[model samples]
Target: MKFNKLPLEEPVLKGVQDLGFLYPTPIQEQAIPSVLNHRDLLGLAETGTGKTAAFLIPILQFITNSPNNKVSGLVLVPTRELAQQVYQDAQALNKYCGLKIVSIYGGVGKFPQTKQLKSGVDLIIGCPGRILDHMRDKTLQIKDLKYLVLDEADTMCDMGFLPDVNKIISETPTSKQTLLFSATMPEPIRKLTKNILKDPVTIQLGNLTSAATVAHTAFPVPSGLKKDLLLHLLDKTPTGKVVIFTRTKYKAKQLARDLSKEDYKVTSLQGNLSQSQRTNAMNGFRKGKYDLLVATDIAAHGIDVSEVTHVINFDFPGTTDDYTHRVGRTGRAKQSGQAFSLITPEDKQLFNQTKKKLDIEIPLESFKDFDYGIFNPSTFNDPIKRNSQTQSGETKPKKPPHFYRKSAGNKYRKDVNGYRRSRSSSSGEKMKTHTSSNNYKRRVRPKSKSKV
Candidate 1:
């Protein structure tokens, strides 16, 4: 369906057309009407299904009809990569509508965001952490916020942002149109909606386990041999731009360095990167300055680069749903792509469970000359378990969510420093929500819901 016919304002319609959006994806076709109708929405969609545009089009329409030029619509995302992505899409779609959109997040200068707040912006897209920072400083004000959107709600909840998100919602007026979109409606997201939304219209895009366009595969290589397998596949596979998904920020950087060392164009995205550095990475990646991008789940949804030929999972993700989302980076928009994982013995169970969750058989691909026995538990260096007794005293990761110390030190202790388990890492336990970062929910009528 064309976006113009979805109860959008003339200017918003013009803007959508100007962006060359002639058709709507399955999620957009269902969610847009609900949003334009001002109904609270709960939606689920796969990545690269034009989800951002789904919500942004209606937001632009509502705002265009009553342009506040201030904080009228607010989009809350989980990471900086998503913040930029949502803001960039909103701006792109509303370029002809004269709406000011600002992306606010930390790990960079705050002055520019503060300045934008002062000057006034029609829509604001941001991560919960940085937005709270601005709010605390009294530099960013949203007294006039009308629409409150929680994109990737499951992720926010997983990142332990439920408390922080509650505080942010408290800051916004209760009499607001709330939209919560998640790939999976976890307990936290369900409860969050119960507190915030008023008779929300729920749209389930069916029980689709995985993206049909992506062909999944798991190569049962030993842990130590992951890099060699990745290199071999990259050299032989017919790939467009490729994305190498890792478990941690350190691993992402290390992989990028290793690949770059082999003269392969590469970059990485992680929380450790400053805003400018991240911008550089995304810009370079999108512009084809890099053939492979090593990233954590942070960029999984936000990245919408089309025709990604392959998705390489160097490490086993924590959840089966995450496995779906990670591999979803490719084979989008009806294009076929491959998802290959370098699984070790420890991941054998996970690999089995993941296939069950995806409800598809993942044919194993064996390496001709690669030896997996060395990278297996017997020969691979065993990781050490650190004694981080908390103040009752429990241990937690001192850094990123990926850093974790498994009790079975023999398997995970190789580089225990990064995962020297800390309490903070516990709070930031990764959630497995995967949806297109570009999605937006709009409505024209309220719909009924079914009980779970």
Candidate 2:
């Protein structure tokens, strides 16, 4: 229930207290002890359920008790963002312990990381690619690894790094403690577990691949008007940290730019930016430099900021798994949170799948007369039509066409010859034929008769 009763070291307890962690979430409550006891664990918990702390806390305590340079613990994450996050947490919590932690991920030089390895670190927190690089060069050794953690396992598999992960694991001692974590357990993950983890303790929270704490809602609107709806909601919402999830890095940048132009202090995270740009954005967000954070899903991993009151899904994520991770940004650490999705009519089916996956109904809320200000549904029915439909099964009468049109049955009025002629009721003018030439002939015949 509490951090103190979990058999953690006194130093870790002090750090946890300083960090204001009182009660453990479901995953933490179950997984911490297993990790502390040095048992292999396969934990299935949604993001933001304290999965990081579940593994990190114990590893820190263990390394604090005994430390070495042969990489005592190895954490394999799926993305650069997550690797940095784990490294930061380890560095922070293990500050007093004097345990060295190195973060190795792509987008930078191998020389620096190799140089860091030469200096000796007790732990290696890295992405699959960089870790594989070290293994290929025989520069890093994990044979002495006592703790091996696969964080966000499903993501790793999705990114097509399972072979790399397996190779990295093979380099380590088979007797090492393996901790595998995933948000969803697809069949591949299950098979990977069966082959890799040995008689592991299993812990799961919420429905599979879904966050139970997050309240989900979708506002059906046109894609073009999504920005307007986002602004309106931000203006109307209560003050707290907010994360806006965009589908692409370009969208993330554009969203941040537009929001900043609107005079709202905001930050952005994406793949294209350099490491410094990412660091600045993350630090700004964590230090309250900006209350609004716009990011792509890749940048969103390992962002464990607190007091995030809302998560706005500016683009409906591609899959239910992604939706779970996006919403998990909020409702963290037992705090209440709300996630709103701006869905187009095309995304309705995806929204419904999310609902079914999450096993909950999230009703759409309307601000009457506001039309939510920006979102216009493709199938938007008139309020009058809605009222009539409620009374009868049919929609209300259709108004006359806005453009002028003659009656449908008049071929003379609609065909090619009708353009120069007048109708029977149209000013009651007589019609003239283009081929008639009798006027000049009659005048000539009268002249001829006078001459005779």
Candidate 3:
């Protein structure tokens, strides 16, 4: 259905046309009417299925009709990146309607956010943690809120934001209309809906398991050779835009660094970076400044990059739902895309479960000329180590070996000297070293007062 076919106001129709959206996505087509009727909605759709517009269009229409200058609509997301994305989408949708929208999230100055709240906004798009911070400071008032949306409800549950979400919901009036949109409805998300939504209409677009447009392929290699396989695939496989996923932030950063050193336009999105750095990385990727983005699952949420031809999973996600979310980045907007995952013996069970549960037939591919040697768990610690040797029997220059040791409940890295140094891990905390090389022999350091 088209935007004009719906009961949207003239201003909304103008905005829709301005954005060049002639047809509505399946989710948007079904969700807009339910939201227009003021019914609670539980929308099940994948990331690239226009879920953001599904809720934003209806909410913009509602706000445009009501003409509220105070905060009338609230959208709670799991990550700051997602919050910014939703806020930008809302602004675009509200262009003709002239609704005041503000996004709030941690890792930045709360003063500016407070100033925006004090100036008064009609809609708020934010994460739960920053929203709670504003609530505590009495800078944000939602008692007059009429529409509440939990975008990516499943992700919120995964991030342990349900309790904070409930508290924020309580701050709003019970008569408010609630809309929950998720790719998959796990038990926790279902429970959240039961407690929050009232007589909601469920709109399920496709099978909640995986995206239909993505072609799934897995390459099983020894863990030690996974990075080599990744490099081989990336070098040979032609793609327009690509996003790589890693299990940890450290791995994402390290992988991106290694790829950049190889002269690839690559950047990383992870938790360790400051808010500005994250924004720069994301904006750079969106603006086509970077061809590849390596990111962890949590940090990659709310990323909507068009023309992403490939999604490479360097490390298998913990759950099938996460795999779906990662691969959903591609094959968007009726475009076909490929998903390649570097699978190893450790991910055997996960690979089997993903195939069985998601009903996806992932054909295994191998590099005919590449060596799949015996798996060494230590060599898998860093991607640079994997590329040390080439197919032509050439070796790259190796860096100094680092050792990890636990001392007095604190983890530190031991260098060539008999001193311990601390480094940041995926969690952004100074912890034990994560990299080890087979060339270096393990040495135990004696107790010493010197710290390096």
Candidate 4:
């Protein structure tokens, strides 16, 4: 459906045209009307499904019609990055409407936010923690808040921000219209919907599986050879604004550093960095300053870069939902995208589990020239198995036997005998031996000495 046909105000329609949005996505088509009718809505769609516009457009229309200078709409997100992105979109859509919009979040100063709040904003886009802070200090007031949107509600639950979210919701009037949107509807989110939304309209766009427009593929290689395979794939694929998802912040940083060393314009977004650093990385990637962005799941929340042609999973995601969110970054707004995952032998179980849960077959691809060294799953049982049968049968040092240790106060007792001795409570005597051992040494090692 075309956005122009929707019951949007003239100013909002002009803003939509100015932003070059002629057609409405499926979620937007279904959600804009319900929002315009002031009905509670539960929008189930992944990131980049035009869910932002689905809610933002109607919100702009409402605020433009009412012309309220006070805060009427409140959007609670999980992260500061998402808050910033949503605020930017709100500003763009409300350009012709001339509504005041302010984004609030932690990890930065709150004085400016308080000043903006005092100046009176029509809408607030902020994270849960910072929004609660403003509520506590009475810097931001939402007593008469008309519209409440919990964008990425499932993410807020995952981040353990539901308590803060509930508190913020409590501050708002119960008569307010609530809109909860998420990529997946888990049990907690469902319960939240029951408690908050009053007879809301539920809109489910796609399944929990990957997007239909995205091509899912995997390359099974050893952990050590993943970087080589990624480089090969990057060299071969015709990609623009590729995003690589890593499991850890350290890995994202290191991967970005390594990619940068190879002369690829790469940056990273992770929790460890400062807010300004994260903002810079996101802005740089959006502005084409970086061709590739190596990030953790934080980027999977609300990153809305339109030119993302590909999403590469440098490491397998922790869950099927995360995989969906990561891949959802691409194939957005009806645009086709490619999702590639670098799989190691250890990740096979997780990959298979995710595939089974999503009920989607991810094709396995291998490069013709790429060399996948001897990676045997059976060799995992015996580390020396591969080296022991080399062409030049050279004897290598066997790995040390594993030992268990228990800490007694500051000192550690190494149980080389493989059996822990129990003391009789009544007599304070050692119990009978459960196993026989040749070495029975009771050495008192200093607690200050480091164990190797």
Residue 149 error, candidate 3, Å: 0.3
Ranking by TM-score: 3, 4, 1, 2
Error of model 3, residue 214, in angstroms = 0.2
- Evaluated against the true structure, the overall lDDT of model 2 is 0.76
Q: Write the per-residue lDDT of candidate 4 for residues 211-314, one digit (tens) a residue.
A: 79888877766666677778777766667788899999888988888777666888998889898988999999999898888989975575788788789999
lDDT of 2 by residue, 1-452 (tens): 78888898788888777777898877888988888888999998888788888898988898889876669999999988889888887777775677888999988899999999988888889999999998788788888889999999988887788999999988888888999999888778999999989999998776665466677666665544567667666665564778999999987998898887776779999988998889889889988888889999878886888677779899999987788788888888777778887776557678778777767776554333334322333232212122245555677554422222242222222211101111123322222211211211111111223565
Task: Tell me which of candidates 1 and 2 scores higher on lDDT.
Answer: 2
Lowest-scoring 10 consecutive residues by lDDT in candidate 2?
414-423
Which has the higher TM-score value, candidate number 2 or candidate number 3? 3
Tens-digit lDDT track of model 3 for 1-452: 67789888898888889999999988888988999999999998888888899889888888888876799999999999999898898888888988889999999999999998988799899999989998999998899999999998999998999899989998999999999999988899988888988999999887886677888777765554556677777666667778999999887988888777666789999999999999999999999899889999999996888778789999988898899889988888877788888877568678779887888787665555555443322222222224367889887644434443332212343222111122222221121221222322332223446788
Q: lDDT at 44 for candidate 4?
A: 86
For model 1, how does the per-residue alpha-carbon lDDT over 1-452 read when each residue is reduced to its tens digit? 66656777677778777877777888889989988888988777666666787788888888878875678998999887888878878877877788888888778888988888888788889988888999999987777789988887877777788888898888888788988887666677778888898998887765545578777766665454567667766665656778888889988987788777677878998878877888899889999888788999866657778857778888988887677678768877767777877777567668768777767877655655544432322211134345466677577644522322332212443322222222222321132211212111211122336689
Pairs with backbone N, CA or C atoms under 3 Å apart (clashes), candidate 2: none
Worst window of 10 by summed lDDT in candidate 3: 416-425
In each prediction, how many residue pairs overlap at the backbone (N, C-alpha, C within less than 3 A)? 31, 0, 0, 0
lDDT score, candidate 4, position 206: 64
Q: Is candidate 2 or candidate 4 better by TM-score?
A: 4
TM-score of each: 0.80, 0.80, 0.83, 0.82
